[model samples]
Structures are given as structure tokens and as C-alpha cells.
Target: MIQNPFARFLTGFVVAAAAAVLPVAAQQAASKPDFHQWAATPPMGWNSWDCYGPTVTEAEVKANADYMARNLKSSGWEYVVVDIRWYVGNDTAHGYNEKDPAWNIDAYGRFVPAPNRFPSAAGGQGFKPLADYLHVRGLKFGIHIMRGVPVVAVQRRLPILGSKATAADIYSKEGQAGWLRDMYTVVAGRPGAQEYYNSLFQLYASWGVDFVKVDDLSSPYHKPEVEMIRRAIDRSGRRIVLSTSPGETPVAEARHVAAHANMWRTVGDFWDSWEQLKEHFEVCNRWAPYIGVGAFPDADMLPLGRLGIRAERGDDRMTRFTRDEQYTLMSLWSIFRSPLMFGGDLPSNDAFTLSLLTNKDVLAVNQRSTHNRQLFREHNLIAWTADDPATGDKFLALFNAQDQELAPASEAAWASSIITRQTPGQSQPVDVDISGATTLYLNVRDGGDDIAWDHADWLRPTLSNGTQTVPLSTLPWKTATAGWGQVTAGKSVSGADLQVGGQRSDDGIGTHSNSMITYALPAGFTRFRATAGLDAAGAAQNTGGTLQFLVFTQNPFRPMPADSVRIPVTLAQLGLRGPCTVRDLWTGQTTSGVAGEFAPYVRRHGARLYRISTARK
Candidate 1:
């Protein structure tokens, strides 16, 4: 309801008047595309790729646009992008079809929306109607494109708009994308190369395109075509925000990439997997310093809510990430100043997904916070900090990368698991001291992604008190619970021989993730040991079943603190002083005190974002 469109209109009028009176060079200089102004904050919106893949229908796009306007537009989520292969009318599920693909293009070597797929383009209208449809609702339209001329265009040697040369004059057969045959590389500085790019952007500007994601141009650091696209956007005289795509984009080219595009991907095709989420913790930190130079490091789409309804990866279902992991994804991306393009089908979004997208205070950090960086990454506990530009308060984010409910939430765990998702399905050594403990709890839980088919095993289990040793399975377990089938003693969850990595074990226990088994230990038991791994039966499914292990002296099934993962640190540890007020934005709690050590807790895979400001007496 705010006057954002009005402000933009007013700014345009002022700029136009100023340009009229200025010299040509000055006006041109002022008109150059400085992308920072286009997306002052990280861009947020929805993309079709995750939910509908290359086959997103116009009706579906409209439904999502309607949802965003009705629910999320006021939060500054405006750009609705059609991701990848919109021109391929015959595209099928799980993958793009290269055989006799129904391609759509104009006479001038430019790809257009397929008329059969995009019904509005039945009479050469091509996305203009769809773009206009969004514009009227106070939303912006965007589209995805590969960074070269269509192969059919190059084969036919189609004419280049606004230039004497044709598509063949500017293309190369080398260095083409392995996955798709849609495009051939357009050589840098070749005749009509710039013109071909210029014509594309000019056509897009005419269609009211406000953003474009140019793919396959960043991972190998295709500097030439990237610069040409940057020039083309600037030359079009429209403020279309340029974003580069599909990265693990060489961190070496960080400087040049930031200067040219509004946002570049830091990692590639992030799905709702704990492995991907675990890796991004390191990737985000490395790219933090390069965030604010007129651009951002895109952490790719939020693979939250419902997904894979006729898409590339999974069957139609809700996101694979656990609820707490969903929070972790949002917290990391926001605090790192990465663009958030929600990848779910919007109309299908449940209330929880809607809540994730609409939190104002969290979105503010992505938009306006400064000096964002990793505070620490000690063991599996990681923290990130950023500064509020307006209030000069510090924003702190604490995360527990451990899959199980580890501490500072419970400082008394017999063993706290860490770094298991790194090389999943492999056995990890577990050794914990249990001297004087009457009972021992063995636990396994999902690593914040999903619990489907996560098989856990305790191989070669033993208890040792120096000279004497005992097989853990020999001891009668007091209680056993598994997320799936019955927990088994000295066998697989299905009561088969204890096996992992195709090897059998004579002594162990097997269970599924989100499971726990407890045992009453005899007096003088000094230590417990096991080699833990995913049973081969579960690993063979390749369902990305990740699990974490834990050893606790007390019963872990009891209710933990509502805020479960609290880490204690002094004000000095956060570089602060006396009389500081800390606010948990997610919890909506304000703690006012002359603080020493700050102990903030969140449940498993949950994050606590603290806003610290000086308190007045």
C-alpha cells in the first residue's frame, strides 16, 4: 500500500528533466546501469523452476503473481521470474528434452515464449501481455535465458536486429553447455555480437521486463558475454536488474562479477538438502566481504514449501528440509545479504511457508543491514553478525550445524555429534566417557533435511573399563524407539545381520533416524564406543537419508527447553558493553539488563537472531 511506484515515477521525472538540460556525456554517464540502485536490498520473489520446472504454465505464473501481490508485495517481494526453457513447449518432467524439441524464436535470432505453452503469445505477443498483467498488479516481471544465441538461429544464420550481420557471424561451436542444446556461445567482440545482445534487451525492455537471469555465463567465468550483457542492459535505457546464474562461480572472479551484475550465485541449484545447507555455511562466509559492491552473492532459491510437482528432482511433496532447517536456510540467506527467490508454487504454500516469506524484521536485515560477516564457526556451532545501518545495533545469528539437539542447549550431553553430513553413509568413530552414569541414551535424528529412510547403525559397539570389555548389545536395553521399523539388537532395523558398507557386524544395534534407545549401565562402566554408519540397505536407496548420532546420560526423550540450542557468550565476546538491550526478533522477546554472558537458545536446526542496542537507564 505504500507509494513505491509513485516514488519511482517521481525519481524518473526528476532524472529525465535533469538529463534534458545536461550535456550528452554527463547524461550518458548518469544513465549507465549501476545495478545497486535497482536492488538496494537483496531481491526477493518467486521462480517457477523449483515447482514447475521448464513446463510452468501461464495460468500457474499468474496464480503465483496474484498470490505475491495479495500476500507478499508489501514486504518488497515483487519480481516474479519464469526460470529456464520457457521456449521449449514440449519439455517433459525430470529433464529437458533435446530430441525434436519444440523451439520458439523470432526471425531475428531471439528466443520468445512458445505460443503453445504461453497461450498469450499465440499471435506474436510474446510475454508483453504477461508482463503487463503483472505490472498492473504492482509487480515486476522477469525471465531466465542462456547466455548465447539459440542453436537453431545459428544453424539458420538468422539476422541480427539492428545490425547488418547474422547470428552465424557472432557464434562459436566450442564451449557449449553439456546439458542443453538450445544455445551456442556468442563470441565476444565479434561482428553483431553486441548488437544481438542489444536487440534482446531492447525487446525485453519493450515487454516491460524488469529483471533477467542470464545463465551458463558465470561458472566458467565467461567474462566477454557477461560484459556484453551488462552493456546491452545499460544501452537499452531501462533499469532491468541483471543477475548471473548457476554458480560455484569461481571466487577468483568475485571483483568483476560484483561490478557487473546485481547478484551472482555463490552456489549452484540449492535444493532442500542438509548437505547443501551444510556446505553453504562455509561458502557464504567466504563471499561475505564481496557482498556490498553494487551487488550480492545469490545463495540461489529458497527451496521451501511444496516443490517438485512435475519438476526436475523429486515427486510432488512438501520440501525435504525439516521445519528447523527451513528456519536455518532463511536465517543464513538473510543475514548473508543474499537474494531470496522462493522456489515453491505460491498458491500451494502452506501457512508455515507463508510465515517464512513474510517476516518483516528478518527481511529488513537482507534489505538494509551492513557489515555482515561470520562471527565464529566453533565445532558445529556457528554464528554470524551484521549491523543495523539506521540504529547502529548489532544483529547476531547463532546456528547449530549438528543434526541432533546439541548444546549450548544441553551442556551435559555424553557425546554431541558434529560434521556427519560431510561424508554421509560412512562410519564415524564414537567414543564417550560414561564413568558413574547409571544410564546411557543412544540417539539418531534427521540432519535437518528429511527423515525418509534414514538408516542408522552402531557397529562394533563396546563398553570398556580399562582391562575388561563388553559388547553393548549384551546389555538389555531399557527402551527403544525408531522413526520407522522396530529398533534391532545386534542386527539391521529389519532384523538382518548388522551390515554397513557391505560389511557384516556381530555386535551392534540398528535403527532409523529420529530414533533413541536407552540402556541401564552397570557400576564402574567407564566408557562407551561404537562405529556408526548408514546401513547399506538405506544407503542403496540414494534418497539422501542423513542422520546424526548422540549419547546422553539422561533420558533425551524428555521435553527440552522450548528454546533448545542456547549458547552462552559474554557481552565482550560480542564486542559490547554494559546496559545493552538484546532483542530476539524471531521470538519477539526483549531482554533488558546490564549483561555479562548472553545465553540465547533456539530449538534444533533453529536460529536466534539477536538485535543488540544500548539500553537507557
Candidate 2:
């Protein structure tokens, strides 16, 4: 059962502060001041997770920090973050050390950096020496933490710094992170819960830390703890930027997060894969409107340059994205203005990767653009736009979410061309013109009908070119996306017989509502013939199953975009229909006197970014 996030803060659990140990320095720090002002813009930085994983040493961090301070510092990249597992003395790569985990903490029930890994943290000095190291070099330091008090701290019944209660008094087993077993949730409104958090940040404040990324708090969206952390940071009397992570952070909590964090992740840990990057086009768009003055929607780290040397996910190597795909990643992230956190090892950057990072023109959009949003997505073609308030110009990003070599990565690709609704036991013949079509898409939409129990299938689907006929089942679908379960090639979504109308067949794609199956057309195929209906499993009852069938001559965002059209991006679409000159950001070329449409040429799985300076009409 889902626990109410606010229940821990209930009236009965409320514990009034005894005003014990509120530091004198904290009293003057003005914790309640507008935190949004501390981070007027999204924080740009380098992080250690992608390259070093849990095993990054002090030497490696300083190397990357040195590289950034000398190279990317002038470009507004400042924060140097130490990601997860910093307190584990013997942390390993590819994930956390679950069983027999080694830990390091000070007597005050607060975690300190592992001295074995981060040598400067030795002698109980904590991160002050390292933080000072970066500070002197004109860089800010940040660290990642799991939400709540350390389990070891609770096990020891360590004293809470500002209150009489011990860690054991405030912690409950409720809502713990499933993946890691290092921490326990601090029950809100209980004695010492808030004080323990305040004391934790007070130590960080003493170390001069500028940023803190709290993980496991956002995915399940630990609301009470987030509020507690916010209060704790304020009470610590330091201006620290707060970020939340490991997302698809429920969009339902947008307002709550925007009010609390400097940035919150929109998707799960993004990697150097086309599929992961493609998923962001939709996720970023959905969270764009919630971006506020202090809070930005993060698209996770840029997985470029040398990675996985000792990281959690992959083996050590340069990023796997193509040059075109790399361009698309940067363009989309910039246009959306998601807080730019470079995740790869910086010192190992090759020429192309360096070019991607140091490109001033692109970085400007992320730093300065306003009113950004996805303009529209037609077929596999997508566009996002943002405005430059200072210059009154427009920043446009046109994305081709198609990849010919790889399957389209969209979860549910949508387009409406030919549409029909099927009743519970309805059977229908499908015939569609396939003349000169590069690809054909068969879709089952949840629109205009109930979504539950929407079992569907194509039976004996065939293609003919007036002379030769080919069995549709003879070739596999180029790309398949499902809504409920996996799309079965010659069986039902459940991998059973493709039973439609009480008849079982084995020669077509079986899927559910809100599904799409894409097939690359044969060289001379002119017609597609098939029989479609609700699968016998869902149609058996005939009470709540209703689905819409639609076909498209174009791709519904198949990674292969050979048939995808270059959508005409008209000035009228951007609400600036007059004359303007558009400059291509990547090529440094300008097109003058552009009037109606300003369609920039974008490649498959790539993007085209433009800066449009409108002329007065």
C-alpha cells in the first residue's frame, strides 16, 4: 500500500523545537531567505559517477577538477560533484556493495567522506580540505547523499546534535530505499528528525559545500523528508543548491519539487545509448512547464567522453552515441535548459567531445533562454522552442527522433490517418494502399474508447505488389512498441495463440491498445491485407474492451526515419509570422530574409538548432 507522504508530519507526531543548539552562525545565516535566489540559473558542473563509479579516488577527482577549472571554468561550469557511495571505504564499481558493506562516520552520527578514498577527509577534518582545495581553484564542491539518517548511525543510537533524542528515536523502517540498505527514513514531526537533518547540513556548511544532490528522495518522492531537508539546509545557514535524482520523478509532484529543489531528474539514469536519449524527448517535454526560477527539470547527466572506467553501468570506453546523435543530445538538453551536468571523465575528452562541451553558442541557450517548450510533434518530427529575453530572439530545436540503423525508441508513437473502432467481438478485414510507402505502421489507440482489456492482433497480414505476394509474417516488424505487455510476433501479447473472435492464428503481430508495430515496406509492395480484432482473451467477456485501429504510411517514430517527413516549421507556428533571419547554431551559417517556413535540414536520429532574430514588420 502507498503510504501518505504527509502522514509522518501529522498533528499527533508534531514535536515542537526546544531551540537546543541552534548555532550562533546559523542564526545570522538567514535560512528562510528565498532559496531560489541562491541558484538563479541551473547549476552546470562535472560529476564523478559516470567515469569512476563508487571507486573514484582523490587523485582522479582532482585531475578532473583541475581540467574543469582550467578549461571549462569560464563557460559557467563550476560545481564539481562527488556522486554516490562516498562514505563507503571499500565501495566497488557497477553498483553498491550490498552485503558486508563497510561504512565510515563520525561520532556525532553524521557521515564523513571515506578517508581511504578521499585522503583529504582524514583526521576527522571531513571534506573541508577537499572543499577548500576546489575553492581556491575557483570551483564549488557538491556531494550526493541518500535520504535519511545512516542505518549505522541509528544502530549505534548516535546522539542527534541539536536535540535530546538519538537517531534510533526518530527513525522508522517506513519507506526505505529498496536498492540500497545504508539508510533509514527519519520519521517526520518526531523529536530530533528535523534537528538531525539540520545538524547534518551544519557539518556540510562548515565544509563550505555549495551543492547537495539527495537521491532516493524523489523517485518515491519522499515529500516530508524533502521539506525537512529544505528546512535543514536553511537552518544550516549556508546557501546550498539542492537537487533530487534517479527519476521519472512522478510528474504529479511537480509543484512540490519545484518549490524545494534546484533541479529534479525527469528520467532514470540516462546513459550513452540512443534508446535512453530518445526517451528524453517525451519526458523532458512533459516536465518543461514546471521549470521555475530556482527549480529546473534535469535530463540526467551527459554521458559523453571516456566513461565506465570504474563506473556502475558499462566498461571503460568513449560514449557510444554517433556524432549526429551527440548533436541531438546537446541540442535537446540545451533547448530545454535542463541543468547541465557533464557525467563523463573530463580529462579523457577527445577532440569531438571537447567541441561538444566548449561550444559557447549552445551553452548560452541553456544558461539564458526562457519560455522554452516543445512546439509540436508530428509523426517522428519534433520541435522545441525557447526565447532569449535579452535579445528578443528565438532558439529553436528540430529533432528527428528516427534512427535508420536502430529501432525508434518512443514508448507509444502516435499519428491518426485511418481510424476505426472495434467492438468486443468485431472482426474486420484491413486493406490499405502501400504504394511507394517506405514503412507501414499498425496502431491500436486508447483514444475514443476504454483502455482496459484492449487485446488486439493482426491475422494473416499480407503484402502484394500486383505481381508478387509476400506473407507479412515472413518478415519481422522493424520496430514494435506496446502499451500493456511485450508485442508478440506470431502470438498474443501474452505469448499465447493469436486468438481473435474465438479463432486461433499464428501469422501476425499481437499487441494491445495504445500500441504500434512498424514494418519497412518491401521494394514493390503496393497493398497490405490483414484481419484484425480483439484477441479472444479480451473479447471473451465482451463487456469492457473497445479499441481503435489506425494505419500510417509514415513512421510513428520508428528509430528508422527513412519515410519520416521534414515537417514545415512555419513562422506562424512560432507566433512570429513576419520576416526573420535564422542562424544555424551548429554550422555558424545564417539564412537571411526567411518568410513562411524555416525548416532546417535535420538528419535521422539528429537535430537542427537555430537562433532566429525577427525583423520588425
Candidate 3:
């Protein structure tokens, strides 16, 4: 009975087919070469990008690894990944010197750890020494690499190892990525392309690397290169986990990605912001059907705790997310079963942040859960449900996406309406009724170009009976200052600075501009549709702005008014029946109830996790 159109479509074919074919698929998946042998569960680890960016030094990597070994290793956190441009000798905390990178390469054509940055990698030892150091402490080592053959190798015309062809012979001129200029893609069928990949993995194996996060290969999904990497890893006699990055990876390529890479990113470089976090709910849902065993739809790194100490984008500071939002982020990532790669400076973690990372009961959901899906999403309210395969416990996560706080208020005085809907030639406003209903839903549709600058279509309808006005700029829309570069590009750019009304300001950027507003409905209505068009003077600028509204409603099942309330669970909600025990995962407290609700207060932008277990009669 999910109201969302996409959810209803998914329920029909995807869910039904999954139930019928999963057992066999699970069995065959286990036998696959890139299955759980490398990552039995979603890889739990620490990545350095959020803190140090591309300039993380040996000391920083070691400090984080040491902290993990001493503190977090026992709780399943292991990999110490040094991310991006590590070979660039002149790299700084701000960004990398991509053009004049001082890459460490040997006579053939594989990148090695820079000795000046990683002192232990001196004397031609490569990362073997550093990997050995981490291995001794019961940890693993990882490094980031851009997909394709190094451009320098092609310039030098280095011979491909174990092959007659040179790097130039196998490299494609049209295969270079737009962002990184150091590499060019390998033509899959060209002679020595597979051999070049084999040599690269062989060198990485020699360095004892346990993980390789390959970037620029996922957003467009370089299938040929992925297959080459997979083949190379198999031939290298190493069990390295291959993680694809900088994504919104095409969900249609799920089978190819699953067969090759251990994990694939579902979003691009996740940071600490509510706008990015809210965007993830949709991305994760699209990729949720693909998660299993070793093949994880990575939600990128967890940008928690203290971040941007020396990051590429933004100044040094603690995460901008509120405490409630942090909890919500963690809960969503856990229930979705995305790989947990903490992106903060591990050595600088405070006790509260550490508690969020080390929660075993909550971690169990990420490590062991099945049939994970978005149960319902109404306006700013979202819910996800999953089941523990070992035990028949059910886990439910509810999220409130609005920026405003949810509080008790009188429903009788409230009225709601559809503010305005504009298309190329039409604009209309209509009234809605919510007198007896407990939920309200808002659906925003975008008919503009689907380029990086244009925002994606977002729908956030919630059950409600009261209303509050919210400012357009105050909503969690991505905004940027004038001088801000394209570091966090794409739909992340907020259209707030553009013209708002139908009139254009003398700002010299645009012509006609459009904006959205939220209004209250009258009473006793369920749904409405709206359309809008955007026009900008410049080809690259966005002409539309986003707006948000708030509503207050009591939990219909529980009918209680407090920060916390217990609502009874039924067979319909959990897909189970009879008496059940509700245990708060965070508080470690239990309440005996008959397949009913458990009480826990969810913070603003935060979440509460519970283990609902049926009682054996």
C-alpha cells in the first residue's frame, strides 16, 4: 500500500522477482570469485579524504591506523585507506597539483608510494613496508588510484610488462577523464591493455595492499576497465577489495559492477551537509536492490566527527550537521547496508563521535540484514525496514527530513493547500484538506535539463494536521558563494543567488527566474500535483529555487504527545504477528509489548534504532 509511484513499481517486479530468485542467486553469488572472500560484510574502515584530502602524509595515515588498531579494530573497523593523489609530491591540504604531479613510477608504468610523503616507502620498498607495519598491528592498508594508464607512462612510452605493446599503443586518446589529467583509459581489446592492468595489480600485490579504491570509473561505469581490474586481481594472487568511486553509478549496470568490484559508490564524495544527506535517501533507494554479500552500493564515506581539518573542499571544522542529523545519517547508512568507511580524522575523535561509530547493536544491522527496502516515504518522513536473517528480529528506521523541529500543536486550527504549480504556460494554486488525516505529502518535479547544475526531482510528503511557514533559503538546498569553485559541483549548487520572482535582477547572470513556496491545506485531502519551468539568461545558471513547509501531526497508532512515545506495531507494519519484545539499541533497554511500539525520542535530523523480536509461545 505504498503511495509513492516508484515504490509501487519496485514492489511489483523487483521485490517479487527478488523473493523468487534470491535463494539461488545468493547461492551462486557465494561461489563467484569476488564474493565474501574479500568482504564478507560491508567493509568497515577509515578513509583519509574527508580530513586530509589528497595531501595525507605517512605520519597522518600511520596515526589513524595506530588509533584504529588500538581502539577500533576489535569492533570490526580495519582498513586504513590513503585516498587520492598520494604520488603528487607537491600536494597540499587544499588540493593537488594535478598538472605537475611528481608521480613515483618505475621503468614499466605503475604508480608507487612517494618516498618523501611515505618515508617507509623509501629504498624502492614501495608500500610493502607500510602495509607490513599495519599488518603487524592487525590492520589492513588501502590506497586510491584513478582508473586508466598513467599519462606519464604513455609519454615515456614504457613497455607493458609481459607484453610486446607499449603504454602508448594501448592508451586511448578519447578516454581521458575530465577532472583528473594524470591518466588515460585503456582500450579493453587493444593489445597489452589487460597485461598493463595485470602488471599494476601485481605491483600492488607486491606492496601488500588489501584495498584499491579506483576513481573516475564508476560515474560512467567503465565496464571494460572494471573487467580488466577484476581479471588482474584474480591473477595477482591477492585478495584486494575493489571499490569504485565518485558515483551515482548507473543502477542499470548493477550486475556488471557486482561481478567485478567489491563495492561501488552510490553518491559522489559525501560531505557533512543536510542537503547532501537528504539527496542520499533517493540515491540509496535506487541502488538498494543491488546490495548483497560482497557487492555493496557504497554511500561513500561517513563524514562524521571532526572533518575538513585539511580537506580539499571547506575549512577545518567539526561537521556542520546537528547531533540529531548525525544520528539520522548513521541510522540510514546502517539500515541500507552501505559499507561504513568513516571519513573523519580518527585520531581526533571525541567520545560522543566514537560512541556513534562503536555501537555494536546498530552495527549489526549493517553487518547482517536482509530484504532491506524503503518501506514508506511521505513528505519529510521516511521509513526503512529490514530483517535479521539469523534471528527473526525486524529493524525499522523512521526519519523526519524537515529542518524545523517537530512539536505538539492543535490540529483543529490548521489549514493546508497546494501553493502554486507552474509549467511552460500554466500556473495554478489549489486547496487541500487534512482534518482527519495524520500525514501530508509534497512532491517536487523538475522538467529542466538533467545536467550537473540542475537539481533532481524530490518528493517529501508527510502525514500531518498542522502547518508552519518556512523560508526558501533556509531549506537544506545546496548553495555556494560567488568565489566558490566547482569542488562540490553538480546538483549541490544552490540556486538561491539567482533571481527569485518572475523579474530578473541586474545581477547580469539571468533573465526570468522561478521559485517555489509551501502553503497550508484546508482539510480532508490526500494528494496534489504541480509543475514548473525555469529560464536563465546564461546557459550554465539555474533559474529555479526550492522551498519547504512544516506540519504537526500525532502518531495515529500511538496517540501520544511527548518527545518520545510508543506506537503499537502490527503484523502489517513488520510483516509479523503475535507478542514481541522491543529493545532500544542505543539505550540497551527492553520493554515487553505485544507486537506493539517501542518508545524512543528521535532528535531533529536524527534517528532511533530498535530490535523488535517476536516472543516464542
- Candidate achieving the largest TM-score: 3
- lDDT of residue 369 for candidate 2: 84
Put down candidate 3 lDDT per residue, 318-408, tens digits, no spaces. 7877887888888999999999999999888999889988999999999988778887776656778888878878888877665432232
* TM-score preference between candidates 1 and 3, better one: 3
Error of 2 at 82 (Å): 0.1
Query: What does the lDDT read for residue 363 in candidate 2?
Result: 92
- Which lDDT tens digits does candidate 2 get at residues 1-617? 11123312211112212224555544444335567777767789999998988788888889999999989999889999999989888887866787877788888788888888989888888889999999999999999998989999999999998799999999988777656778899999999999999999999999999999998887668899999998999778888999997676788998777777778888656778675577678788788776666677899899999988988665788888889899999999998888888988999998898888888899999888888889998766899988888888888899988644322223222223322334434657778887888888887765343224566788899999888889988887878876555688788875568977667786888887667788887788888888877776555421334666777776444353463347578898887855898998888899888999876567788888889888865
User: Which segments of candidate 2 are over 4 A away from where they belong?
Assistant: 1-31, 403-560, 563-565
Q: How much is 314 displaced in model 3, in angstroms? A: 0.6
Q: lDDT tens string, model 1, 591-615? A: 8874787876666666778788876
> Which ranges in model 1 have alpha carbons more than 4 Å from their true place?
1-28, 404-564
Task: Provide TM-scores for the models.
Answer: 0.72, 0.72, 0.73
Error of 1 at 587 (Å): 1.9
* Candidate 1 minimal-lDDT segment of 10 residues: 1-10
Q: Please tell me which model should have the higher lDDT, number 1 or number 2.
A: 1
